[model samples]
Target chain A: MSHGRRQKPKNLLMILMLSPYLLLLFFFGVLPLIMAIFNVPTKSPSNPNGGWHVIKIVLHDFRLVPAAWHVLGFMALFVPLMIFFVVAMSLMLDTDTAPWKKWVRLAYIVPACISGSVAVLLWYVLLEPTLSPFKGVMHFFGITQASQIWKTSNLTYILVFMAFLSLAGQWILIQFGSLQSISGEILEAARVDGCTQFQLATKIKLPLIRKYVIYMGVLVFAGGLQIFVEPQLLNSSVYHGIAQQWSFDQLSYSLAFDNGNFGEASALSLMLLVPSLIGALLVIFKTDMFEDVNFKSPKKLAKEAKKREAAAA
Target chain B: MSIDFDKKAPATPEAPRKKKRKISIGHYAVNGWLIFWAIFSVIPMLWLILAPSKTDRQVSYKNPLSFASFHGYIRAWKNLQDFNSGVLAHWVINSVTYNLAIVVFASVTASLAGFVISASRIRFKKTFLISTLIMMLVPPVALVIPLFIEMNKVNLIDNPLSVILISSLYPFGAFLSYIYYSNTIPPEIYESARLDGCSDFGLYTKIAFPLSHPLLALLAFFAFVGNWGNYFMPYIMLPSPEHYTLPVGLGALFFSTPAINPGNGATSVPILKPEIALAGILVAVPVMIVFLISQKRLIRGMLAGSIKE
Candidate 1:
């Protein structure tokens, strides 16, 4: 890639270098999205006439508001708790001030390694009234059936929040890694300046890792809106009446699987697509994630800078 | 690189020690919060290990964290195997094949493309890189509808090939590999190899492959856990019972058991409740093991590409 003079990358080399990535992206991403839009069928699979009856659906018709209510209901507790526990656990793990650091760090990270349904089912069983291992405690409070709590009210939201607590291990690890990258000198200075532990956490470390926090924030937004597995698996007698279509993902899933309406399902998928794309764009534009990478090398950029100065002379 | 407080070691005593430094109540308060939440995180896992060891009735009655008889774990395992003609066995095999395929194919393509883009001369590099980022950001759900149809059109439906082809393109893996290479594969190595008359393929095989173990392990474990955990794609793509993965199979088990949830469609097949708990353990243990083994390498790999930038 290096040359005496800087030049744009060659077209052939780009094709050779990036074709696998581009192909996968096309097949799995761009092409699929385009085909989803084109999934409009001329006839229903059951229709014998095979007549031109292009399917049409509206995003507003999906009852997005109700779905949004459930989504936000889950997210309200989920996102803030994610941020709180992640920061708390990561700060504790990163600092030398904690006891049994290794054991606690391992325990905190165990949830991240677990997949979604397993974690949900584990929690589901533990919290179930008749199946709960915590039955003694629930009985002490006159709550015999764990399902009774979620049955009468929307207490499943709390269950969903508790289930997501384990999943925070992934983000905490990411943030912890970022925190580890901060220079020790800066923290020592803050400590020496009579900063309390809370002040050290909020003022110095949090500010420096603001970009990562933003990164996790946007991702949390995306993930919260698209929640599926927990609701799908939890939609049974264990926690009866936790709405099946709790999120748009579950909505679109049922729309496809139940009604066999890929067209409407595609529409629902696209609905989720818009905000996710926006959030990603915000992260890209608002953060330095792409700052260190570009087509031109540092040497080439420096050479260009020198050339500009010489031309001015 | 991980930060060391060595710089603070030297500068500490020079400051006035007049202000008595005691571990404040706030520090202990923070630790208390950390310890509480840390246990909060651990309790579910501890429950998973302990719950299945109790009888279904005992589970509802006993202290959740207590160890019950080992008989419960054994009986649950047997019942899980006996369910649906031992379909959980088939799900395990399918999961292994699918995850192994993803780990191999995804890693190879990702690393090769990553190496070429980062080290070799390439045109429209910025465009390629941006597109990869865009591809990564597009939530996987958005692709499900079209991919479902696409696999059907290609006659790959109900086939493992459907899942394999769909997962073959790890865009994030490629991005990570690109970052690892751009940062680790020094320009001098490339120059020296070229001077020694190394061909492009040879340089990659001889030089790059050997040096990418950390990245490779990181990507492999990532692919393993991601593919292992994934429920949606396989759920939609594979309609047949035999093609179900552990997650999908476990979902089927949850919905099938009656005592576990009497309200869930009559639970046609009678399955003990603890069997469901045991199955959850079965579903989780593989990924847990992978994470533990590759934990250090994965952390270092992530930090290498991320923190430096």
Candidate 2:
């Protein structure tokens, strides 16, 4: 009884601390998801069979295949390129011993500030042959007209380039920061064992920061799947209907707003949500992403270290 | 064995010398690569800044990298001011207000919840942590439609609170803070404070909150930048131009102007290329200012969040 009474106040404090975040999460995160799931038309004259019918309707929509292809193609191009370049650049930044590294890092993040509609606007100006700084290079490729660059066939590349510039810097910084977590002792030992710089980075540093890399991959893949802003801005602003409903998120938006089909929109959104949730869970549980977070007191840590030393002795 | 040892010893020094030469080459190569990418990353922003200084005709015909005159900037600003009787100023204010609210709410709640989750012996802590992780990963685009509907039902569709409240959830910030507090502040400090008669909330206020400046700054910076650049949420939630944030307002400006799309028939409005570029600069400047001021703290915060020990 006394123990139970003693525990009540601590639990109350925990509740007090957690309630604000929990409340916000409930209202914004969990509730919207629940509302979306329930908002899907389980029963209607067009779909008397209910849930499967809604899914079928969404799956069979004429725009679905094209939008799916666009998203898939984008992910195929954007995700791998982003991961490769970010990882490579970050690794290079980590290995390079130069005084200008700080300036380079700052420069990398400059484009990230220009994002969303602004990035699209900036890129439009940058790509327009008449106004582009790289017009000389564009002319070398025999491209003088914006039409050549803004064509439907080249959109995937354009979107990838825009997304890469805006996102790669931050990820490079993040991966570089993760690289900093690698202990110097390990690197010293590798060097002492006659490991070259290349071998040391590949064999030791790469393996050590594998989780952070995977984490980046998962995030990049998920964010890539929802490629909306660049294409949406391109479709609406620079080019008229050139990329209309070019992505699944855009399709969902049109379905909800233009068609006034909230049910179908909700269904489509839930479909996208499922994969992201599954991937997040898989990465969280299957990897050691959170494993190294030290929660023990210093005294307990010291005791464990002593115990390990005694055992080794 | 003695001959082999002597030979190896002599070769070792030479090998290091050769390796030193190779490393310098590699170092220069890396520097060149980073410099190239840096220029690529910064060119568009620099172009945007300088483009506004040229007239629309000059913007297209003149040297793309050259600056024309400050008169073009004054002309663009005047045109922007004339846009909808100066609605751009309202959008700027709205963006600042909404982002500030989001930053404050997100940072405070995230830190408090993170401290509790990491330090307190709370029940279902794993559940909370995993849910936060899942929430972090869930692409927010998936929730927009439902959230719009919910907001509509609550008559918050045109209200700024809808955008602010939804954005303030900031699961990524919460998760980052959780990771930071878990790894950074030792449990002994909390224990010692508690034993010295600090309450659970007191431990957070006294020990955790003051120590988490980098975390708080990071949370604020991210929440500010993410919401500041956010288009879809504010675009959907706030229907009126008066309440529009910078990105959405930029969208409106783009649609109205024949800046990028020459195909769109010319309007009487003077919102040509320079004006549009100026507006884009306006959208980017606040985040760039925040980034410049807090980049060091932002990096330290990122390191704290990602580093294990």
Candidate 3:
């Protein structure tokens, strides 16, 4: 049939457009993952353990527990604080009708320029009393030396501070963007019903944008879980061994490069990857994250068809 | 809801007056909060720019906020040039070349794949989309080792092509493009075009590509910024110092310099706080410039992805 003949070229064109991305994904994204599974560390001849014993080796490693604890502690501080502040600051920004709203948003994003390793450098300067602009504040806390601030126990707070400042601005802006999507008619209705600004924000806007906040939470959690660059750079450059294998990713890196054990490294990486994959799946299925795909559901199509037929009649 | 009623019952006509009084007080509080955080956000960037202008002695002893002269900056630049036979310049070139390649490849492939997935009756569409989503969420840090092994198998480990080809597989960009095309362009346009005998390639080149200027720009800008700031993958892949990107090179500079680790004792080179801060500023300059040029479009593009139509 002509229909069957026409489908061939259409399929060919689709394949043509898709092949480039699909090829890259296959080579880089999909293949490496498969390779990692196969490359999971096995028992050495000297150890004489079982075939799948590398998972046990990675799980029981001394550094593994501490590294996992470090990530959990970081997420504990980061995820909640990020959600609270981003939501609060964005809501406040949305409510303010001042002319300085544009400038405020711009200011929020300025710290983003000092991201990655530069943030680590900048925070060192800020934490070091000798070079910090907020020396008075440090002095008020009865601290006159860098040693007081960069203690081993304070690593969690320090990483959280660096991560928070570098990322909070962008999330605040994104949440503010989410706020803009709320229709004006709803806000106007709330106001006309004599709602205060606080009530309008909390009761209506917060409930409406709950999904966005959850989206932010999932990403922030995932990103925080993979805390590597800050701790790694700090450990290597600043105070040596101060943050050695302080994060899960850093531990995996040390295993592969320093320890020269690729099996244990891949095994540990797969372990770290499981939680993120679960989070991604939860976001995809549990939430309406991809509802904007514009592929109408059957019920929606049926309703639209009904409306069209009514118009024709 | 109770709070709404509590205020609603108190005043009908007088609500505006009461609300105005309350908002002014709350407004000042909000302004105070935002201003305080804004200062926290911007002070480091201001300090980074000014830190390069002061001497090593001044950096430790002088007022942290004060600026001295460009003499120190010029000296730092000269010292950076003198170090390792001027590898910093090579890093700048490598960063630019690698990022530009990624931008071109990511933009073209993502847009094309997105258009086809959304517009055409592609088989296994859900599989492609879900895989892309999973890939987007999979942190690159987790894959670096495996990718290193894969790249080593093909002997492309230290090659710039290794970084470009890997980094350009931006699943997030493809996802954004998929969402943008499907949400913005109605299927009717494609249908009409097909009715008029426009080929599928023609439909993309003449229709989708033309309509995707904003999405393409967004993809390019994000690709540049994201990979420009990337330190880990390139650090793992390109082991040679001369082949380093800006961040890895900066990391090397930090390692050699005694700027942060003052306890390492005196160094013969003049690579001190000023030099390190200068290098940091240099790393941020390109991203800042791009951001400044496309500030409005970038904000709009960000909103376009998250906004539910």
Q: Report, for every candidate in turn, its global Cα lDDT versus the true structure.
A: 0.71, 0.82, 0.82
Residue by residue across B1-309, what tens digits does model 3's lDDT show?
A: 000101112224546667668789777888899988888887888888898899889888988878999898899888888877888899889988888899999889988898988888766777888889888766777688889878988999889889999998988888888887887789899999999999999989999988988788888988887888888889889999889998888888767777777666655667888888898988877777776666555555554455654
Clashes of 3: 1
Runs off by more than 4 Å, candidate 2: A42-52, A293-313, B1-17, B23-27, B192-197, B266-268, B300-305
Instruction: Assess the local accuracy of residue B188 in candidate 1 as a C-alpha lDDT between 0 and 100.
Output: 83
TM-score of chain B of 3: 0.89
| CA RMSD (A), model 2 | 5.9
Tens-digit per-residue lDDT, A237-257, candidate 3:
898889999999999898888
Q: Is the docking of candidate 1 incorrect, acceptable, medium or high quality?
A: acceptable
**Which is better, 1 or 2, measured by lDDT?**
2
What stretches of model 1 exceed 4 Å from their correct place? Answer: A1-18, A40-56, A60-62, A95-99, A133-142, A152-156, A159-163, A236-241, A295-313, B1-11, B14-22, B264-270, B297-304
Per-model DockQ against the true two-chain complex? 0.48, 0.42, 0.44
Query: Which pairs in model 3 have colliding backbones?
Result: A41-A263
Error of 3 at B15 (Å): 4.6
Among all windows of ten consecutive residues in candidate 2 chain A, which has the lowest summed lDDT? A290-299
